[model samples]
Target: MDRRLFIKLLSQSALVSYGLLACPYLGWAKSAFDYALEGQELIQQKNFAEAIKALKESTRIDPNSDWSYGLLGRAHLGLGQKAEAVAAFREAVRLNPLDTYSRMMIEIVTQKPLPKLEKKKKPVSPLEQEAYSEEALMKSELKAEEGLEYQVKRVVIDAGHGGFDSGAVGKSGLKEKDVTLDLSLKLHEKLKADGKVKSFLTRTGDYYVPLSDRTATANQHQADLLISVHINANENKTPHGSETYFCSEKASSSEAEKVAALENSVIKFDEPYKKKAGYIDIEEILLKFEQQLYWNESGKFATTFQERFKKWLPLKSRGVHSANFYVLRMAKMPSILLETGFISNANDEEMLKKPAFREKIVNAIARGLA
Candidate 1:
């Protein structure tokens, strides 16, 4: 049966079905507004699939309603149904040419390259010329503001543990510090060769650099992103996947907290976090407020990075996590810690030892950063 027919039948049944629609007049029937309102609430609750159902009913009832179509578009976008989102947004714009939200969303969702304006054959009249500069200015401003495009041009690559810090060690005697440095160097080369962005390293050789210094270097370089590379280890040596971590006040999971603790243990060699000193430093206070924004962006970036890496990396992707990583905590920009693989696991250890696998890891990280 057709979906519309199914909806119509469902709507009829909904007349007798309690709490199905937020309709008026004894709840016997629902207007487009009522259905749209239900969709809106469902969307607010982040139940995009159900919201789509209600939004579709609203559009069916009032095909010309711009608000219904706009809500429908939002529902589609929430579910990452991009093509459907664009279609609904276009319909909303078609129904009401002044729907700024839907109009901007269309460009944002599509991300189509801006067409270069062709040079005119003849100069326009003085009146047209007088308006041209201002129009061009507004057009550029609109694209930048409404486009919501984010770019990362400068990245700080941190090779976790140096000098005395050997980091995690495998049964085969592979040190996390050595593997990280090698990977970081390869990643630096890859990023530099790509010429897509500038990559800076916190440590260039076998020397101990404090965790705080790493974040400081990233800030001093004015990096757009900071990525600390490390290998993971577990006592049981069973886990063998890679994970990405972003800084947060609280870990996303127990495993995340443990991972953070393991990496943060290096702080013992560095000047450890002294118990809240007598005077709460103003810098610390400011960081508390500002870091939330950076942390959220970093979390989003970690997710994106994991998705990109999962496609090409041979190691199983353990996904992104939120942890209190000291190296990432003080970053003035978005930061992440990449647990490339489990050095404790035999298979992962052997893979890390291979030059080809290291190259693959470098490429994966480079693509993820891009």
Candidate 2:
């Protein structure tokens, strides 16, 4: 199908998914239809440059529409336009915070390695709202002595795997991709509601992404911090607990090999044409390790996370370890991978389904980062 038609179909799909098709009061239907048609036509012609214009016009016609931004972002992504694609995806989320696809795209495209956004006091939901106690105030003052010089402005929170790629499956049938996405969304909501830190997610849907692309997203956004969340599994099932990993300047041969293997596995799915041998090489990845500054600042951030995890979470803190995971290796700033818990563990699996439990996990994460 032509780009215009494809976009039109996508817009229709988005509307249907949103259950807003029968709304007579909102003139969104006609406006969405028009934009989708023109946007798809331009996109199909490989006219991404012009497609953005038409797609944006669609959004202007219907200010509350997310379809326009989504279609426009797709066009930009196809055209190798990172900046515009980032903006478009961001707009999609702003229009509909629950639009998982948009949220994921924003996380993938705009997350940067720099620490620019600092935490600010913002409004929170009734459930999350609470005044800082005198004791808490005293502690904050004391904690400032050890506070890292950099401030957190924007954070990139990655929900590992999605859509076609379910990283691991639990006995209860909960997909790793789905669980991470759920937790990431909860974290995003908490951060936004708290009005303390701006946050972004890497994948908001059930789609597969290149591992390299995930790290690139964080670098692009210049994120103050990057937290890639995942559930752990093992053949033994005996090992069940939460573990956090930070980047290591000196990854042992075995550790580096494992990191390369895990990240490389995803590359094959994205690049099937390369020989199987292509996945075995770690030399290239090791060369890229120096890109992340490991001297002082990153270490402090990692340490802070480890300290907070023990203070808050119920799970046993496996303590922070260094690894050569592709996601952590590519971040230009402080980054960590959080293995929330072993999904394979029967006990952990049950707790994963509860909303309150998930919120508690989110709180711990926020507090850890704070």
- lDDT, candidate 1, 125-217, per-residue tens: 554443455457657986777444347799999999988889999999999999999999988988888899899999999999999999999
Candidate models: Cα lDDT each: 0.82, 0.68
Whole-model lDDT, candidate 2? 0.68
TM of each candidate vs. truth:
0.60, 0.54
Worst 10 residues of 1 by lDDT: 9-18
**RMSD per prediction, one decimal?**
20.3, 18.2
Give the top-scoring candidate (TM-score): 1
lDDT by residue (tens digit), candidate 2, 86-138: 78877776665656666656654554432233456555433222222333554
Q: Give candidate 1 misplaced runs (Cα > 4 Å).
A: 1-149, 272-280
The runs of at least 3 residues in candidate 2 whose Cα sits more than 4 Å from the true structure, single-residue gaps closed, are 1-150, 249-264, 271-296
RMSD of 2: 18.2
Q: In candidate 1, how many Å is residue 286 off? A: 1.7
